[model samples]
Target: MHKEKQQNIKALFPPRPEEPQESDCCGSGCSPCVFDIYHLQLLEWKKQCSDILCNAGCYSKTSDGETNEPLLSPIKFSPFQLLSVQQHTHNTFLYLFQAVRANSEPDQESAVTEYTYVKRPLGISVGQHLVMRCSSDGNQNTVVTRAYTPISDLRASNVGQFEVLIKLYENGKMSKYIQNMKKNDIVEWRGPCGNFTYMPNSCRHLLMFCAGTGIAPMYPIAKSVTENDLDDTFVHLLFACRCFEDILLRNEMQQLSLYWNFSAEIFLSQVESTAESQTRYGECVKKGRIDKGVVIERLAGKTLQQVSILICGTKSFNKDMINYVKHVGVPDDNIHLF
Candidate 1:
């Protein structure tokens, strides 16, 4: 492994600062102990570590089920300023940021010119993520950063801005910080991360299985495939969530469905009480999760070599889908976990 990749694996989770022991807790009841909160953060960190390693091929296995050499490469980050923040759903927010280019002038006087402040367009692929870093003013020493994939199509008419859909958890520190951010706030970010690159006509069909915020990354891939006229690629999305309200980008998904070869199946784990069996939940929606029956039916006549399966969700969800697809004869190389 390269030095940077080695360092990344070692530095997956920075050492946590020591906290007062549970024994020292006061008699007053606390809904969630500090230790408990830390534990949740640790779980997320561990999952991210595994994802990074897997994408870098640290844990990739061959057809014979043997470990293979790891691939390593470093990504660069840059700073960008927040332009707008719009609410997507009850808990989800859409963030728009304009890129900030580095100063290239020889003197301070020339640097002040308006032309010197030209914004650099974010260079990102169809299925990549960005690492965002933010620090609270009260505790500037403690910085909280997280990885989020932008859902907007940067290759479209929008040139100077990019958008990200973030679902804020009640106790999530980074989410709270972002919620209070004002316009013109500078956020340090780096990116174009992830191993799955969508090449035009790379596969006859792209099948994506994702849940919750996992749809953020899946959006770009689906949009690109449907919009690219040069490539007659087919896009299939198997998206699941607890309710229709929790759906991230319903309008965007509807637009993509207008394309001839685009197909999507929205699965709801808990359908609303008012929704009847005959009621339309919009285009391509179902009442349960995507199972073997749906997969086999959708991919009926296609060869395993012509189909690429992309999955992103909780650890258990990813594991279950991967196992099922593998049992159905999909090659290991054709399945990507994100």
Candidate 2:
């Protein structure tokens, strides 16, 4: 009788949602992201589990008689308050946020609840990304979500705070919502998602090809390698932008280039090459798109066995970069597309 009851209870339990792979995301900021879908499925499963447990005469509550929930979860949204917003360019902004304590109590003086801040790292890996959720209308039915990779240092020293660089689009639904946000406003975030793994000295050289905001994920990995005293990986960053003014993280890139094992070159597609401009930015500034010749030049000294390639950009940009590297004999296994 006990064995039969166990089987029946197990049969009533809902199947857990399968997490999506990194390759499942096209990096195009699509609505209802694969992660988003998985989160919804997970929430449904949790609800079903609660119902099943109660019906089966099992303990569904914690020792305190309250429902148990994780402080942070990759599959669920958590409330974070915006600490500050700094505009980087006409369209780009850097936002800093702090996670709000989920178990804060109401103040004694009044009915208002006091919000406490959690002081700890966000638990994101060097190359992982997170999802941000926002509602377009006052109604929860109309929601918009986007994925972003934080550029902040995820070390324990910088606990309780995280930063993300956002490029606001003219007609983007999430952009509109973000632009109108104020300090202290609560935002829903869930993550530490992505499949890029990095180990010290995993490869002798790293060739990073990124355009526009694609640098978000690439920056952290490059920074991690450069900052580690034991990591001997040489990083060659080929960044493409419309003009010098459009270069995101220009100052950060310049500082990174000062490292012995790091080098960066900027490709300006819209700006014409001039003696003055070249002098200001140095030989690292090239005037044209990153084409076959540029790729060949960058790969000239590096051998196939010593190099790994990382590419992030628009779909066409990623496609072209892959073709360029493959044409030069770099295998698909050595290339990672973000």
Candidate 3:
């Protein structure tokens, strides 16, 4: 069965205009089962953590067999197995979470009050995924979940805990849930899910592209390049948004440009009015709609191979940007969606 638009777009919920009205016929009654939503969320989590190094199973259950002996099973899985299960589990969890939310409108003051850890954490590496479970809110009611790359060099710092900077989505399900979390509350989280891992050695000229919260993974990739002294790489990032307010991590991302090899540019195409009829940020933000053609013009003449484009945002935003890239001749393989 196909999932509804609402359930498929996890982590990034649609705006009011995007959401179907309550009268649209069904929600809790199988229109889009909360189970499906939870699964989506869990799928994302598992995909990233699938690369985690596991020597033991997190859960060991006593099983009865034909032999009737104490059936002790050694746990082992290829990266493929782990990733597949991780992905499936995540999707299931994501869908299920909706049910939890619908059934229980958690108090806005609670953070991660419960905690759970996987059996074994992986030793993350270049092209590896990292998931961080942190307190996302100031209250203690709900657990806010988001994904990020571990910025610390994997070899140098085998940090036990992963860290991801989260920008509170305005009243977002997960964002609002996290913003109100109290200290000591625990949110369950697992490994790196994105196929967007940056290869430090593979490319030199990096054209890192982003729009909004999508900037999270790019930060780690850029940091890895600079901090590890990958000077051969010249970085040019084109971040888009309506106004400066919709922008996130401006100061931090700008600082990355200070690196001798980095060049960063910001375009407010639709800040207030559309210079052209077909615009993206202007209408939506200032007055126009997002035009991938303009965005492509901004990224021409770069080493697409060396350049890793990390696009993260709401589902529509990311999808539109992705389709734009393919339309403009960027090899499907070259674009990395975080």
Shift of residue 113 alpha carbon in model 1, Å: 15
The number of residue pairs in model 3 that clash at the backbone is: 58
Off by over 4 Å in 1: 1-77, 101-117, 138-141, 156-160, 272-282
Overlapping backbone residue pairs in candidate 2 total 0
**TM-score per model over all chains:** 0.70, 0.75, 0.51
Clashes of each: 1, 0, 58
TM-score of 1: 0.70
Cα RMSD for candidate 2? Answer: 13.7
- Residues 1-338 of candidate 1 have per-residue lDDT tens digits of 44565565546644533435657666477768665565566445545644554454323334543223321112555567687888999999998877655555645665552222223334455577778878887566878879888777644212435788999999998988888988777777776678666654556888999999989889888887776565578888999887878887898888888889788888888875425653344576678877777777767788776688999888877888897888788867678888
Task: Write the residue-wise lDDT of candidate 2 on 5-120 in tens digits.
Answer: 64676577767677687799988998888867776775577567646633453222334333333235689998888999999987899999887765566777886756667664
Instruction: Give each model's whole-structure lDDT.
Output: 0.70, 0.77, 0.45
Could you report the Cα RMSD, in angstroms, for every candidate shown? 16.6, 13.7, 18.5
Worst 10 residues of 1 by lDDT: 65-74
- Distance from true location, Cα of 232 in model 3, Å: 1.4
Per-residue lDDT tens digits of candidate 3, residues 1-338?
11342133332322212223336545557835544454355445444333221111111222321222111111321111111111111111111000001113444677433232222223444333443344444455544445544433432222123444455556567655544444443444444354454433444566656665555566666766665452367666666666544555555665666677766555554466534553322122233445676667756876553455556666887888888877776656456676
**Candidate 2, clashing residue pairs?**
none
